[model samples]
Target: MSDLARPRRSVLYMPGAKARALEKARGLPADSLILDLEDAVGPTEKEAARELVVQTLKEGGFGLREVTVRVNGLDTEWGEADIRAIAAMGPDAIVVPKVNAPADLHAVERLMDDAGAPAATKIWAMMETPIGILNAREIAAATPRLACFVMGTNDLVKELGALHTEGRAEVMTSLGWCLLAARAHGLAILDGVYNAYQDEAGNRAACRLGREMGFDGKTLIHPAQLDIANAEFGPSEADVELAKRQVAAFEETRAKGEAVAVVDGKIVENLHVETAKKLIAQAEAIAKMQAG
Candidate 1:
């Protein structure tokens, strides 16, 4: 995917074992759909889930949203089979849970190779456990195939013995560390899902908080959360206007052979110009989608 093209602001997780949810997800407004074969599917249901996911991809009518499969961890009995199945289906990405080191990624890479998966089948890592947080940078920097980090806050909370406070203070350090690693490696990072699927107010608050914390988007549990997540992550009208003004001001300065420009009493530099351009581009993309 192009770095310039913003991904689906809300990535909905559909239980791979549930064919109905998988089919329903195709009509949701979520930017991406994650067919989960991990925590969502029990051991007995894993094989069934894999088959359903593979069939869904083969059927191929998911609209503009990207598709991904969250395979069981490599340590699990079904992990290898999940990888092989996913490779055959050729979804946009494969999400690996609880990745602790570069070696974990290397193992998955080899599995993908053996399956003859296309190079475009990227890998997304879950930064959840304490060890995963500690080695987040090393794992993110491990290979070019690493595309993104999906925060697994529930696991992190369990590992840290943390209570769910309003601001999530207990897990702030790990979240920050994960963001740092993702940005350092130029990878997209998503905030974890909010467990209360029907709590609209809480989900909106969490989405806003994730945006403030520099997450590219938020993983979602239900389609009800899609609107809020997309709104929070996407550029606002005010943001687009400011970006346009900044670009105009900067361009005028450049034409005058000046390297810097003052906008609304604030000095704007090249960095500001770059940010404005990105904002405008994102706004345009969103507008096009809305128009369609």
Candidate 2:
């Protein structure tokens, strides 16, 4: 964790080649905009897309939302150019797809260093493949520069040969592993994009499930998914109230020199207090953003 606190409830991916979409995203509610040069760009257009991405970054008009460039796999020809352009332009972060080992992070870090990228420029990994899930912990623990993990549920589903059930039961194991790895490293982890953009009910269901599964946010393919993602990730009024109550109770006990506190007939530990404080802080931030 870079101690750079960002609310990434909704991350929307835009094709790096589409200048119009890039411009239009400035008004969207997405917390992050990913200029995608990987899956979105065609083979013939990869170089052109990289140029457009560089131009967009150089122009510098994306509002408060975080901007990330999703480069092609490091093994590909376009990947080198993508990395070079991104390093030169220097967005908030570079998202590397299909990262399976610590070596991948090392390679990227070296490239970034060679490019003389700022230390503030962070790396976010997409854990999609089988090898990636298996080695996620090692990969996450590999670098202090790693900030977050974005799940590629669609790719993982394909690799595992599993169907997307109503409740996402098939991908539960991999999802759990991703959350565990992220928590172990104290990094933010986002759920993969829900492909059914037109299906509002399906999108909300998936977003709710992701929140229940402890994801910090969900990656989105469409701008329409932004509101639902944001709403799902934000703490509810009841939740904020409960968290405040827990904190108050814990503080009252601490004032009396007591180590342990009981809240709502349940034991509240230091971990619980920390969680409550985080929730309150997030809630306040979201409220302030909404107010403005």
Candidate 3:
């Protein structure tokens, strides 16, 4: 599958400080795994977690799951070492925290290059700070190696001094801005984590909202949230059937010198056909990944 279309429906953050969590992550149903070394690891365990994450990357039993490591911000004491070590090991990408501008990505790219990281190793920016949201476009277009955006809504709420209300009104603008930037640059973007992991109804509602908002997927805190995200983001059986019918109808109409077709009493234009094709492709990619 193309990097842009890779199924990231459920990206789970595994605490790098916990050896058992690292081991258990291998069999998790998440489409992507973020071996987190930033907020997930306490200050005292930073170095130890870094070492463990590096070793885990080297060991390599993650099957077809997209593996990434969330490194500390470059402003932090451990950020430089974290990037250098992670870049060399070369997970799918290095998740950089608190990216406030293009220059932040430039700095991370330089460190990655300096460490001789592979070309396939990309950067996932955490879009959390107010400055980051304000400069979302510039940051999205910052580097060719930057492949995805992961929303840091928890920190965003804290930064904005806003409460986490239902529907996430507090951080909606931030999310939308980063989303526009990500889509404008043709990069994949994931929604922020849902804090109330145990609340299945709330979690499902949040997942639905994220999918409706055009997120490729959502960052999750626990394995229990994986199925919710995957079901919400991945094309369902009904969706696949409708996409197939739409594509077939559109092709038939086009062959007859027509510009559009009707599907379930709604006009399906070229743009709709395009979206249907993409959905079909994404569904196929997800199936292939799971089958493998």
lDDT of 2 by residue, 156-239 (tens): 999999898988898898899989999999899999989989898999999999988899899999988888999899888998
Query: Which 10 consecutive positions of candidate 1 have the poorest summed lDDT?
Result: 1-10
> Candidate 2 vs candidate 3: which has greater lDDT?
3
Winning model by TM-score? 3
Pick by lDDT: which candidate is best? 3
lDDT of 3 at 243: 98
Pairs of residues at least 3 apart in sequence or in different chains that clash in candidate 3:
none
lDDT of candidate 1 over 1-292, digit per residue (tens)? 3742766578889999998898898788777788999999998898988998999989977866789999999898999999988987778889999999999999998999899889888899999999999999899899888899999999999999889887889888998999999998899999998999898899989999999999989999878889999999988899889889999999999999999999889999999999899888877766665544
Task: List model 3 lDDT by residue over 176-221, tens digit each.
Answer: 8889999999999999999999999999999999999999999999
Clashes in model 2: which pairs? none
Steric collisions counted per model: 0, 0, 0
How accurate locally, in lDDT, is each candidate? 0.88, 0.88, 0.95
- Candidate 2 residue 167 Cα shift, in angstroms, is 2.0
TM of each candidate vs. truth:
0.96, 0.93, 0.98
* Candidate 1 to truth, TM: 0.96
Better of 1 and 2 by TM-score: 1
Candidate 2's displacement at residue 40, Å, is: 1.1
